[model samples]
Target: MMAKKYSNKINKIRSFALALIFVGFIIMYAGIFFRGNPIVMLIFIILGMLSLVFSMVVYFWIGLLSTRAVVVNCPNCDKPTKILGRVDMCMHCREPLTLDPELEGKEFDEDYNKKSRQTKQT
Candidate 1:
């Protein structure tokens, strides 16, 4: 069976924020086509601005969450990385890491972070 790919939570959230910015700009640019209708153009502009504002909020939230995440040096790459949950991939090498000893040698499964899943496994 093929293994599932994983990414650092921080990087994923950062990428998502970047995507929102692009989407917001695209939506705003689309408003140019509706120049004939002031109301329609205004609506599009507002929606685009909302997307940007929400992206900023996401960025801010992620920044705070990142500060609280545990930082550890990846054993494989010897580089520092943050772990958001029980199982997270190394930001630099994509190596799987875990704080729980029980999950140390197990396959990299994101489900290990879930309380219900852990309970079921035990």
Candidate 2:
């Protein structure tokens, strides 16, 4: 059996933001090839700028999430890490952690964090 793979929520979001920046830069660079067509070039440049702005928004959201994340000492890695929800993996070791006792021994699932699930339980 293959071992389950999980990434820290904050790390995942950070990587997504980094990827977005790269994509934005690439888009802007592609605009250089369209210099002969001023309209097309302008469109490319605007699109690239929008992508970059969206990435910035995502980065800001991560900052807010970090403030709400629960910091705990990872048992597997023996390092301090933050858990964002009921199920989150250790930043250093990828070990699944949970704050809810009922989910302590259960498999990790992102759906556990959904509002609909919580409502059903109640």
Candidate 3:
């Protein structure tokens, strides 16, 4: 069996933002190659700018989520970390942590937080 991997939600979003920034730069750089085609270059530049702007929005969302996330000391690492929902992994140790006692000792499942699941469970 392959070991499953999980990452802290905040960290995941951060990395996604970072990747977007890189993609934006790459798109803009590709535009330079089409310098002879003004229309093509403009399209590339616009697309690049959009990607950058979207990344900023994602970063802002992460900030808001951080405020709502529950902070707790990871039992495995003894380090302060945040959990975004009912089930989230420790930022430092990747230990599966849960805020709900009913979920304790259960396997981590992201679907546990969905509205559909909540309705179905009841």
Model 1, C-alpha of 104: deviation from truth (Å): 0.9
Per-residue C-alpha lDDT of model 2 across residues 14-114, encoded as one tens digit per residue: 99999999999899999999999999998988889999999999999999999989999998989999999788899988898988998888888878889
Q: Pull out the clashing pairs in model 2.
A: none
Candidates in descending lDDT order:
1, 3, 2
The C-alpha TM-scores of every prediction are 0.94, 0.91, 0.93
- Among the numbered candidates, top TM-score falls to 1
Candidate 2 stretches greater than 4 Å from native: 1-4
| Residue runs of model 3 more than 4 Å from their true location after superposition | 1-3
Best by lDDT: 1
RMSD of 1: 1.3
> lDDT tens string, model 3, 1-101?
99766788899999999899999999999999999999999999999999999999999999999998999999999999999977888999999899889
| Cα lDDT computed for each candidate against the true fold | 0.93, 0.91, 0.91
Query: Model 3, poorest ten-residue lDDT window?
Result: 110-119
> Ten-residue segment with the worst summed lDDT in candidate 2?
3-12
Tens-digit lDDT track of model 1 for 26-120: 99999999999999999999999999999999999999999999999999999999999899999999999999898877888888888999889
Which of the two candidates, 2 or 3, achieves a greater TM-score against the reference? 3
